[model samples]
Target: MTVFVLVSGLFTGPHVWQETAARLTAAGCEVRAVPLGGLGRIDGLDGLDGLDGLDGLDGKVSDPGAVTDLESHISDVVAVIDSVGGARGEEIVLVGHDYGIHPVLGAADRRARSVARIVYLDSGMPQDGVPALAAVPDQLLREQVMLLAAEAGKGAAAELPPPSREEWRLWGSVAGVPDEALDRLTALAEPQPLGTLLQPLRLTGAVTSVPFAGVLCTGSGSSIALVQARVDFGEPAFQALADPRVTFFELSTGHWPMLSSPAELVRTLLDAAAGRGHRLTPANAAGPPAHLRPFPLDVPEAPVERIGRVDLHLPSGDRPRPAVVLVHGGPVPAEARPTPREWPILTGYARYAAGRGMVGVTLDHRLHDVTDYGRAAADVVDAVERVRADPRVDADRIALWFFSGSGPLTASWLAAPPSWLRCLAANYPIMAPLPAWGRLGSAFHPAEAIAHAGDLPVVLVRAGLEVAEIAATVEEFLDAAKEHGANIEVVDVPDGHHTFETVDPTDATREAVRRAVRTVLGHLTA
Candidate 1:
C-alpha cells in the first residue's frame, strides 16, 4: 500500500483536509494529515480516521511558549513520516499545497530514500534560498505582508494573524469555494508563525533525484498551458520542468481544492502517486518561438544602427523626420535568447516605419515581471529622451507604440501627455492587469488613465479573438475612453488572435496593422 502524507498551507491546519482524508481512506489509501507546529489549533478533527493522535491538535501544542519556524514544521512532518510509514516499510507519496510545499520539500530532502514521489498542489516551483513570502502573488500585498511581519517580530509572539473573510482574495482565488467553507476557514484560522514565511527554504539537492508531479488548479488562474507558455520562452528554470519525471494534472477548482472538490482532489492525488498525469511538450516542439514567427505585413528592410540599448531604423534622408518608438511587451524571460529588439515582428514594424519615411526605434526594456513595471516605465522614458535628442529625428513630433503586455506602461503618459508627444498606439495590449496580479495600483491601469488622455490621438489595433482576459481589458479601456470623449480610433481585426501578426496572418490582420500605422503617422506629421 502507498502511504500518503498531506500538508496544508498558510493559516490552515490538518482539519481542513478532513473530507479529503475520509475520501482517500475509502479509496484504500493509508493517509496521514500532518498538524504543523505553531500553525494554530486543529478543530473538527474528531472521528477523522487518519488524524488521530497527531501533534499540536485540540487547540494546543506540546510547548505553547516555544517559537515555531520552518525547521519546526519540517521536523513535525518528518516525525509523522517516520512514525506512520517507516515502521510499516511502505513507499510514501508526499503532497504539499500552497505555502506548505516548503516544509514538504525540506522533509523530502532529508528523507529522500523513503519518499517515492512529491506532488506540488496549486503552488509555485520554489527555488533554493527563497522565502515563502516571495510566492505571494500580489506586489502591494507582499509589501504589506513584509511590513506586518517586521512589526509582528517585535512582539512577544512573532506571528501574523490570518486574513479576514473579505481579504481572502488577497491570498488567492476563491472561485469554487462555498460561503460556509469560507467562513469556517476564517473561523479556524491561526496566526501564522512569521519564520515559516520569512525564513529561507534550504535544500541539499538530494530532492532533485525524486520524481515530481504538479496539480494545477485552473480556476485559481494556473494551468498546464500557462506553464508550457513560460517554458516556450526558453527560460532555463522553466525548461527543467519539461523533464519526463515531472507529470502534471489539472483540477477545475479554486486554490482550496480540498474544500472545493474533495472527491476530485482525492482521485487526482491517486493518479499522481501512480505517475499517470500529463507531460509537458518539450520546448520548441512547435517550429519557433512566437516572437520569431513571420510578421503579417511584407515590407522592405531599412538601414539600422545600434545605439546603446536602442536600435534606430533611420528613414533614407539627412533632414529631420517624424519618429515612432516601438515598445515590446513582456515580463519576458530575462534569459530569452535574441531579446525582444531582434524579434521579427518588432523589427518588421520598425523597418516598415522607416520605409515610410519615418524614423522607427526598437528598444529592450526590463519589464521582466509585473513587479518590474516601474523600472520598465523608466526605461521607456530614457529611450524616448534619447530618440528626441537625435539630430535625424523631429524632436517636437513623435509617437509611441506599445505591444502585448506593455499596455499598462502607457498609463503615466496618457494621464499627463507632454506637449511634444503627438500620438500613442497599442496592438492587442493588456490594458489592465489580470485579476490574478492583485491590485497593482492605478498607475499600471490604462483604463483608468484613458480619461486623462485629453486631445492626444490614440490608435488601438484590437484582436477579436484575443485571450478572454486581455480582450476584457481592451473593452474596458474603450468604454472609458469613449465616456471621456477622448480622441481615439479603433482598428478592428475580426479574425485575429493575440499576437495576431504571427499567429493569424490573415489579410484583415495585415490591413489593420497598416491602418494603425497610417493613423499614427498622420498624427506625427500633422
Candidate 2:
C-alpha cells in the first residue's frame, strides 16, 4: 500500500524533509515534504499582499495573520495534494512543523478529501476563526503580539517574522542546517501578513475522521519544562499531544526530528501513515470531582445593575433559584474604561439564563486587571456570596460556569470552595496561564478546581479537535474531575467547527455551545 503523510516544515524549506523522505523511500514508501506557500522555487506572479518582484520568493515570509498569503499557500498545498502520486497511488500524508503546521493543517482542513494522513511536528495551536499569528505562541519569535491584537480590535494580527541575523543563525547555525542556505533564506524571507497566525486552523469535514498524528520530539520535554524556566507543558509532555486526527508518538530527539534523527523520524512517520494504532496516554491527568451527577439549579436571568461603574447581571427570579454565575475569558482591558467592550459571554450565554429558568448572574468581571489567581478567585467568591445573599435566590444552590480566564478563577474557588457556592461547570477554563503563551487549554489550569470541587455537579467541555495545548488542559481537568468524585459530564466536540468561531459566531460552534450549556444545565431541574 502506498501510504502518504504530510509533514510540517517549520521556518525552514521543504528540503528540510529530504532526509526523512529519503529514509521513507528506502522503506519502499514514497515521501515528499510538501513545499508550502512562498517557500522554495515557487513563483508568486501576483505576489503576496500585492508585493512585486516576488516571482521567485521562497516561503520564508512566515506570518500567521495574512489571510491572503495563507490562502495562496493553501493553494500550493492543494496543488501538492493533487500532485501526490499522479500514477503511483493517492496515499498522501501531511506533516506540519513550526510555522509549517499552519499551512499543513490549514491545507488538510480544505483537502481532507484527498489527504491520507496528517502530521504536526513540534507545532503550535491549530484552531478555527482566529488567524495563525494570533494562535502562535510569542516565544516562537521576539514580539509583543497581544499588543498588536489590542490595536486592531479582535481581528488584528502580527506580521511575519522579519528575516534577521538571529533567525538566520537559529536555522542555519543549527547542527543539521547548512550554512550555504543562509543567503537564499534571507532573499526569500519576506514579511508575511500577521493575520494568518491568529486565525484558527479549521478542518471539520472529512478531517475529523482522517488519521491525524503528531510527531513530538522527546527533547521538548526537557526544554518545555526546564529551558524556558517553564515546567508547565513539559511536565506532562505525553499528555500535551493533541490533534484529534493525530496518533501521537514520542520520537526521542530534538524538536526538528527530520534534521536530528531522520531515519527514526521517517519510521515513525511510516508507522503513523500506515494507520497503525498506538496505545496513547496523556502524561498529566487532571483529577475527577466528588459528585457524579448534575445538581439542579433554579436558573433565572439576572438583570444588569451598576456595580462599581460596571453593569453586572445577577440571578433574579420569582422563586429562590439555584444560582450559577458566568465567569468569562481573558479580554483586553483599558485603564480609561472598565468594560471596554461588553463581555462576549453576555450575549452568548448569560443573557439567556432567564429563558433557561435558572437564577443565572452574568458578571462582567475584570480579566486582565487582576494579577494573581488568588485575587481573581476572591472576586468570584465575592460575587457568589453577593448573589447568595440576595433574598430572592436559594443560597445553597449556587454553581459556577467558567470559561477561558474563568478557569483559574474557578480553580481558586475550587481550592477553597465557599460553603454556600455549588460546584463548577468549567467550559474551556484557564489553568497555568504563565507558560501557555495565551493558547487555550494549555493556559487553562484545573488542578485546584478539581481539589476544590467538593462533590458539586461539574461539566467540562473541550474541543476534542483542539491543538495539543487546549486538549491537554481539558483532559487533565476531566481526569481530575473524575478523581474528585464530582458529578462531571464531558463533551469533546471537534466535529463541530465553524469559520471565525472565535471572535464572531458560526452556526456549528454555536450549536455546540447550546449543546454544552443544555447538557450541563438540563440535567438539573430548576
lDDT per residue for candidate 2 within 70-163, as digits (tens), equals 6666666676677664456557777777677677666777877777777766665455554565434334342444456466576553344545
Candidate 2: segments with Cα more than 4 A from true spot: 1-10, 41-68, 85-87, 139-159, 163-190, 198-204, 222-246, 281-526
lDDT of 2 at 441: 33
Candidates' C-alpha lDDT: 0.85, 0.52
Which run of 10 residues does model 1 get worst, by summed lDDT?
53-62
Report the Cα lDDT for candidate 1. Answer: 0.85
Which tens-of-lDDT digit does each residue in 69-176 have in candidate 1?
Answer: 888998987887787656666778999999889999999999898899999998878888998888887887677668877777676557778899998877777778
Residue pairs in candidate 1 whose N, alpha carbon or C atoms collide under 3 angstroms = 331-368
lDDT of 2: 0.52
